[model samples]
Target chain A: MKIQLALDRLTIEQAVAVTRPVSPYIDWIEVGTSLIKEFGMDSVRALRNAYPDHVIVADMKTFDNAVYEFEMCFSAGADIATVMGAAPLVTIEACMNTAAKAGKKVMIDLLHTSEEQLEALQMYSDAIFCLHVSKDQQEMQGSTQGTEGFYVPPSLSGEGRKLAFAGGITVDMAQALTRIYPHVMIIGSAITKAKDPAAAAKTFYQLKKE
Target chain B: MKIQLALDRLTIEQAVAVTRPVSPYIDWIEVGTSLIKEFGMDSVRALRNAYPDHVIVADMKTFDNAVYEFEMCFSAGADIATVMGAAPLVTIEACMNTAAKAGKKVMIDLLHTSEEQLEALQMYSDAIFCLHVSKDQQEMQGSTQGTEGFYVPPSLSGEGRKLAFAGGITVDMAQALTRIYPHVMIIGSAITKAKDPAAAAKTFYQLKKE
Candidate 1:
């Protein structure tokens, strides 16, 4: 299991500063949607410059104009750009085509996507399907309630598609997912908000290895 | 009817320069999603500083973490911010609450939203329900094919809720929407991409007035 550090609600400077120490342990550095909204693609460019070897994921949560958004992010140095699973299939296809042409990857965020939507998205075998639990849902229902376990859709089982899971991920949760083996395990506040983000990341890193 | 000039696919400098001449005729100055992704909330601040009298909208297209996203945009000087209608009810409520507290407004972009979702959102009467056609849909089906007419959900009528329509809006399209009288008519490439953008904006402005 690979650890993806989600840098959210931070300024560009803070994002760079926090990730500097943890870069080596983490597989992917995610420029979260809020940070991207706060600082733009420059944040992605800045992170890319700071950590040249790390895969930079621009968590754009893109819903429309996929071609333009994907091209912009990939040009700015994003290794993987995300499109909302709730977006139309054509939009998703546009993003996939752009990513394919650019020699990059797309992570489809299944935040509010319906089961039918998920079924339709299974066609994009090359794309990474993210099983995301929305932050608001966590806040409303209490984080401990919903995100503790991995949910592999019945249709996705043994389909050979890359999968990632996100939302309120903790050290214990990370250890649990290791057994099921998602391609990426995205953790946000648990790492970014820790007293020592680097040490916290190192712990998750070692846990993933174990 | 009001004309909202959408600024997308431009650098911050270009967005400012293009709107300088057309600002007088536009009611709302929208910092589009692509511009927001490319330039961040600073784009909203820049337009706010440049056009103090105009209502500056940060089209954040917020999908989750509504409170944080809405607060960030409102603080950055956005008079209005958008929440995706496809977002969860709790998320939409969070955005509406934050907008209400800040004395700002929320425009719910009903892009890819289902009728059931629309029915649930009708409770937020003060929020502007934008009947938006996804940009990719326009490209796939031709601009004139999908957005030529306005759509208001039967449940939304007579509810005293504000209505807005967006996607491929031309001067002629704007004139047609004005007859039905949506609270806002959002125009993007029609004005921003025109050879003489200011002249194009003036035509829409005059059409709204007539």
Candidate 2:
């Protein structure tokens, strides 16, 4: 399992400062939804420029103009851009094609996607399917399995999609996911809000190394 | 009926310049989602500063920390801010409080919300419930009401909520919406993308005036 540190709430300057120390140990640096909206595509380029070799994931939470939105973000230099799973399948397919053509990746956020909708999308572009529990839901269940524990745990077959989870991921929670899922684990407040973000990230990467 | 001009895909300079000409006739000036994200709470501040007398709206697209988001936009001098209808009921209620306290307004973008969820938000905030069809849908609802409508005209009732509509809104489409519903009509690309944006805005305002 790989660890993706979600940098949120911090100002871009603060995010950059914190990222420097954590980047060596972390595999993915998520330019959060708030950051994307707060700074726009320039921040994606800034992060990409800042860390040329690292994976820069822009959490766009994109809804409409999937092609334009995805193209803009990826062109702005995001290694991966996200499309909402709740977005129309056509939109999802559009983003998938955009990502494929760009040689980048797209993650679908199933924040409130219905199972029937998920089942229907089983054949769409093989993008990473993220099971995100809404941030408002408060204090997610760590033992539930997968990333957010909102969806069924790792069967790891069917769609050839890589799995990622978000929403309130803690250090121990990330560790548990590392042991079981073979999926990418995303941490937001757990690292970004930590008193020592580097040390906290070290704790998660340390779990992966184990 | 009111005409709202959405200033999307422009630098703050372009947005301010565009609004300066159109604000005289327009009821509302929307600093669109793209501008809001590209620039931040500052986007609200800049547009609000430029058009002190006009109803400056910040498309914050509040999804989480609703009160915080609403307050941020309001403090930046927004007379109204948008919240996604897909957001939790609590999130919408939080925005209502912020709007009431700020003496401002909230517009709920019912981009993909179902009838059941819309029914649920009957009380608390008499927000401008927008029937938003995303630009990326690519489904092609042609030029007017009779030209293959993607959605039926929005039904506005229950606690007397106001209605607004958006998604590829043109002068003809704006005229159609004005004729069909005595509600706030949000026209984005129609005015913003016009060869003569101010004239395009004037035409929509003319429809509203009728």
Candidate 3:
């Protein structure tokens, strides 16, 4: 279970600064969707340059034009790029092809997908299937309120899914996920929004025994 | 029936120049998802400046945090920002709230969603629910090949599902969608990738007129 440090809401400079201390502790660094939207492809390039040895994931959560998006991020130096699993199978295939061509990995995000769609896309043996809780909108109304993070045992334990979980994961959730999921889990606000990000990340790493 | 022009795969300079001329003919200028990802929030700012009088829809197909993204795009000078229907219902609500606070509108992209999810989310009446076709994957795939450029109804079109269609529309498809669907239908590469884009756009308009 390699740790993936996701930099959400940090500027390119800040992302670099934050990762310099945490890079060795992290197996991968994610240029979050917010950063991508804020700074564009430059965000990918900068992070890749800063951490040449570390895997860089551009969280594009791409919905359409999958080939173009995957190519753009991969060219800019993303070791991994994400496409929404909720996208058509064609889109998912395009993403896989682009990643294959570039010798990169594709992380399929299962943000709001059905079980049928999940079963339909089970052929992606090489892809990392992520279960994400939307930090921007989780608990705004009735959709799982006041929870530090999501605990999806059914989805997390896929038959062969190379699982990756992301959201507002606290220390307790980190330990729980690490113990049971047997997959790479991601935490955003629990680390990035922390008063002491490095410490929070260190604690998460220690708890996960990574 | 309004004409929406998607400025995709063009440089920002080319986008501005193209948007200026096409603005009169088109009702909405889609700062397409491609432009937003390639150039970032600046895409919205530049497009909004280029066509001050026209409605600028920044294709920020957000799947995660809606508040931060909605605020960023709306502040960057977008009249509308997109949230993926594949996002959680809370995400949709957060986006709607942010839009309301910003005095803007939300276009919920129904990309690769099931009928149940669409039926589940029909409560966001203000959102212009889109029957979007993947700009890259859907067009080239054998299933939808040679069927580009038009609006086809979703498997289920329930109440409050205000429709907008896109996937490689054709002259015939555009003519048919404008006549059949009682909503905004998006026509992308079918018209833009044509040898003569303005003329192609004129064809969609001509069809709507007839």
Candidate 4:
């Protein structure tokens, strides 16, 4: 399991500062949707320049104009970009084609997507499927209330597709989830909002290795 | 009907330059999703500062963290922000509450949303329910292919909900849609991608009046 640090709701400077100390410990550095919306693709470019070796994920949560968005982010230095699972299959296919041509990767975000919707995406074997809980749902209800008991659908897991899990992930939760062995474990506030982000990241790093 | 000029897939400089000439002919200046992704909320601020009298919309297409994204855009000088209609009911409610508190407005982008989804949104009478066609769908197929004959569901129209229409709007299409008397008519590439954007906008402006 690899740890993906999600930098959300932070200014560009704060994101860079927080990641500097923990860059050596994390596998992927995610430029969260809010941060991207706050600072633009420059945030991705800045993070890419700062951590040349680390993979950068732009959490665009793109639902439309997949080709343009994927190309724009990838050219700006994103190694991986995300598309919403709820989007039409054609949109997802466009994103996949863009990623393939650019030699980049796409992570399909499965936030609020139905099981039936998940079945249609099984053919895109090269893409990484992510199980995500929306931040608004978490804020409206409680941390443990949204997407807490999500299971990877049999068709996807059985097909050996790359899988990722996100939302309110804690150190204990990460440890527990490691047994199931997702390709990427995305953690946000648990690290970025921590008193010591670097230490929190280090702990998750250790958990991933275990 | 109000003509909202959508500034999409442009650099901040390009967006500003294009709108400067056509600002007088349009009712609202929209900072499109691509612009927001490429330049952030600062793009909203820049446009707001540049066109103080005009209503500036930040097409955040917010699907989650409604309060945060809405507040960020609104505080930065957006007169209106967008939320995806495909989002959960709780999420939409949260966005409406945020907009109400900020004394701004929310436009619900109904791209990829179903008629069943449209039913749940009728309560947001003040929110503009937009009929959107995804750009990827437009490019993958032909211009006349996607969202070719979209109609406002009677459930929403009967409720006196404010309605808007988008997606590959031409001057002829705009003229046709005007007969329906939509509250807002969103035109994107028809103007922005035109050889002479200001001239294209002027033509649409005349059509809107007719």
Best by lDDT: 1
- Assign candidate 4 its CAPRI class: medium
Return the candidate ranking by TM-score, descending.
Answer: 1, 4, 3, 2
DockQ for all models, in order? 0.78, 0.45, 0.66, 0.76
- Rank all candidate structures by their DockQ, best first, as comma-separated numbers: 1, 4, 3, 2
Q: How close is candidate 2 to the true structure, as a TM-score?
A: 0.88
Can you tell me the CAPRI class of model 1?
Answer: medium
The TM-score values for the models, in the order shown, are: 0.96, 0.88, 0.89, 0.95
Candidate 2 lDDT over B120-152, as tens digits, reads 765544688887767665353332323234354
DockQ measured for candidate 2: 0.45
| Each prediction's number of clashing residue pairs | 0, 1, 7, 0
- Estimate, for each residue in A52-171, the C-alpha lDDT of model 2 and write its tens digit: 988989888776667767877888889898887776666787888889999999888777666656786666546787767655555322223334334453343554567887767777
- Candidate 3: residue A18 lDDT (0-100): 78
Could you give candidate 1's per-residue lDDT for residues A1-210 as a string of tens digits?
778999988889999998888888899999999988998989999999999999999999999999999999999999999999998788999999999999999999988888888888888899999988889988976643133457788767765779998989888888888888789989888888989988899989998767
User: Where in model 3 is the C-alpha error above 4 Å?
Assistant: A137-161, A208-210, B142-161
Ranking by lDDT: 1, 4, 3, 2
Provide all candidates' interface root-mean-square deviations: 0.9, 3.2, 1.6, 1.0
Tell me the tens digit of each residue's lDDT in model 3 across B37-91. 8888888899888788888888898887788889999888999888887777777
Tens-place lDDT per residue, model 3, A181-205, is: 5467676667767788788788877
Interface RMSD of 1: 0.9
Query: Model 1, which residues run further than 4 Å from truth?
Result: A144-149, B143-149
Clashing residue pairs, backbone N/CA/C < 3 A, model 4: none
